[model samples]
Target: MSEPEEDLQEEQRDSTKKKKKKEKRSGKKKKQKEEREQEEAQQQVDEEEEERSECVVLRGIFKLGKKSHDVLLTRTRLTWIPITPETPTGEPCVLQPGVVLTAGRVRGEGEAAASGRPAVGGAVLGVALFCCRRRGRRLEEDTLHLHNASAEHTQTWYNTLKELLAGFSSRPRYLKVFINPSSHKKEAVHIYREHVAPLFKMADIRIDITVTERKGHALSVMKECKLDEYDGVVCVGGDGSVAELCHALVLRAQLDADSPEKPVKPVLPLGIIPAGSTDVVSCSVHGVRDPVTATLHIVLGHLQQVDMCSFLSQGQLVRFGFSAMFGFGGRSLARAEKKRWMPSSRRREYALVKTLARLRPEDCQLSFQPAKTSTGNLFEHRDEDQDVKQDPESEGEESWTTNQGLYLSISIMSIPCLSPHAPRGLAPNTSLANGSAALIAVGNTSRSEFIKHLKRYSSSSGQFSFSFVETHAVSAVRIRPSSLINWSEEESEEEGDSKTTPIIQSEGAAFPWNIDGELVEIANEVLVRVHPRLITLYGEEVDEAESTVSCSCI
Candidate 1:
């Protein structure tokens, strides 16, 4: 072999080996880049999946009992993720806004209490009454405590939980309030600031308060209210305030419905802080006048629709009444109003005695349309058309019944009429939101009989079973004094001109109407119609079984 050929072949072999090495290095780099891209893509996918989780607003280590776990706090819930136990993470405990009553810091315990400095021990966060169902039909309450965090952080969690809880049941950023300073006890404004404002501040809610100076001031405020800027309306007073607010709001809704430039709006949800002579509406809705419970109910944004009785005369709405009583009850209320300015604690007793002394059965001409009670759900609300369809035969049928002699009292109640005055409620069988109102037409009876019937209300036995009283579930009622109507003239002629005495009195003698604890002017001819679910109140919704005893309040 020649020396030149050997050198060229050696050079060719060296260049080929270098080319192979370069190819191998390029392939290795490409593989590395592909693997890096794949890992990045997988990371992106994992983050996207986590986004679907109840996004962790706040997370930390929570010490529950002796065990510790990682925890997450959301707007409406708190979740625990255990770390050391080596157990599969399962469905987290849901702290429902409605069920979770309160969140606060726990007082020092054991060694922490023994120590002079509470900060030496870690802080604790506690939440009360986390209601859970074990057998699907029973309610179980549990309290949760999170320990081992710093004092400031624990407080922060508490405040955050409160803020989140407030946000859970409601989306109201601002509220419009009407406070009647002259109502019953006249502490409405004070009650509102003390009990209501703090919760609102914690919940980050803005309050626009109006202290009513005059009798009809609240009505005017509600009528001219700027509906867009408010989340809901709150009334701080008694039943009178509720009546005023409801009337104004319903009228506004009607006006908006008739307007061409604006859309008709739903009546804003309303909350009542009981601070009046009688707070039947509040008791019926909240089960109690507990300031904290009422405030929390409003903050949580719970709502229960209720029926309303609208009093109309001459084709115009005069007022909206949650409860009404005629005869001696009305007379008693009227007499009480006149004596209210006396300033004596015995004024009510004096008025009651005086009214009862001269009380007699009222001779009234009554006409009504019977409500459909076949479904056994007299408390359920139904539209007019639906009601008619359900009882087609009774649609246009009207029943006229006359109590020509006397009636001790006739109470028309939309709700159960639960109040401190009437503990078991005025109309115990009636549903608050049902389309029907109970007409408890109590006929004339002796004082002793009336007393027995009234005493029955204090117990759970009920007052309707008495022989002197009769009740009818009615959708609407038209009432006029038989002594003033043509029926009176017909009866007078039949009795002949020999006995010239009138039955009741002249048509000008207007009997006062006791409307929601307030005495109001009522004409001789008054028609009351029940508007089903006319107003929505901040309260809880119990099932039919629970509805009857929903208000165990004083």
Candidate 2:
């Protein structure tokens, strides 16, 4: 190597170096392109996974938009369903759980691929989101919202459906429904077959309907019903029927006093459906007289406890429930059996008017334990001051005058409202389970005084006003026709009503008693006590609507 040879060699070496560097840079660029493509493919796979995660199975209903449709709850039968969402819309859509659809109509897979989302799927999902757009997104377990719908509407639908679903989560409840066709208005059979049966079917309530044939039919049913076989006994009749049924239940032991030993019994829950002309029990308990309304209350499953009372006559059961009377009214009630053929409207107009017009004082000895002795017992208050003021001045204030004849109306009741006609019913302070019975005894007086006494019974003033009267709460009572006495006789002796041979009062005597509304001619004179938590009732307590009165003077 000469100088010229060295320059040419150096140039060749430079050229070779430049060629190697270019080859190295090209290899590195190719490697980077391959890595970027691989990264894009991996991202595409993850996006597909996220889309798949959105599909969910959701069961729901949607109201038809002015469209009447037949829904097949069972694949075989078509039910004409209401278009409104409130009426179990019956439009059930089973969506993939946790799938959130967008606010656009469902089209083809092309739009889904183009947008890289779930715009369409199976036939079911397609029908559900037909008018709206949908995509695969996580569906929340707590709430499933339909796209493009009103938010408030969606929430309302969800809550109702949730409750409906919750109701079905449990097994069906069997209920024994008792209907008295002879009760007030007498629509028991119709109510049971139409209103009550359908709802019970919807709610899966097993039912056994009994049509009462006579006045005491309901009482006999209550006495013989296998209470443990059912969750509750529902009465679809008037208050009188319910009273009869309840009375019979409460007096089970008393009715069987002559038997060996009282048999152990299971307590049954009582349900009421207002179907009678005077649906006092329904009005008092549920505050509504509609059978459907009452059935809804039963479905809600609320229970309450109410007190019961019994009336006894010399070793025989007469009547029970709230009211027990000894007066012209009692005689009238006994005669009401003859007027059963009269229509409810006629009976209502006639029963009260006739009883009032034909009223006559019947001499009787009415007595009960003082209110002070047994707090819950039916007692009487002798207004000495009022008695003295009303006494004739010529009588010279006879303190313990041997005998006097008079007409009287005795009423013993727990709740104030005796019938639906009297909504003000007993005072608001009254309690159905308070173990107290109010007694209103009206004694004989002048015709003007008798009318005034009747007015007092219905007066807004809760206190009784009378000359020879007593008003108090008691647990037990006794009544017998007074012995006939001659005013001409100088001396008076206790003379029994030998003509009728009235049963005499004595310890451990079985008396005819009436419990609830059914009159048992032989409810043996037996002990009657409150059984706490025995009667499981539904809706408002009887005492919740009592009238307020001032007892400060007591």
Give me the candidate number with maximum TM-score.
1
How does residue 268 of candidate 2 score in lDDT?
60
- TM-score for each of the candidates: 0.67, 0.54
**Candidate 2, superposed: residue stretches over 4 Å from native:** 1-172, 215-225, 248-266, 316-320, 370-407, 426-429, 456-459, 462-469, 483-534, 542-554
Each model's number of backbone clashes?
2, 65
lDDT of 1 by residue, 1-554 (tens): 99999999999999999999999999999999999999999998987765744465677776767767676765334566555433356655543221222222111110000001122343444332122222211122234556755666666666566555444434466899888887766688788788778666655678998998888898787778788788888888888888888777777787768853222335688888888765778878766655555665665566788888888776666777777887767777777766767653367677677755554566665556667652332333221211122222233565433333356788888888776556567787787776899888776667667767776665455567766666778788776766542211122333322211223555555667888877766656788888888888886532221122343221
Candidate 1 runs further than 4 Å off:
1-59, 63-69, 72-76, 79-169, 259-265, 343-345, 374-405, 484-503, 541-554
Worst 10 residues of 2 by lDDT: 110-119
lDDT of 2 by residue, 1-554 (tens): 79999999999999999999999999999999999999999999988766553332233343334443332211111122433334367666432222222211122221100101111443222112111111221011111113323445444433433343334311227887778776665567887788777666654568888787776787777677666678777888876777766766555644444442232222566788877765655666655456665665565455667655544344444444555444545444544544767775675456556655544554554444433333532234343322212213222322211123343466666555434334455333355666655665665545556655455433444435456555655544445444432221111235332322222343432222233433333323232322223345654554322222332110
Quantify all predictions' global Cα lDDT against the true fold. 0.64, 0.48
Global Cα lDDT for candidate 2 = 0.48
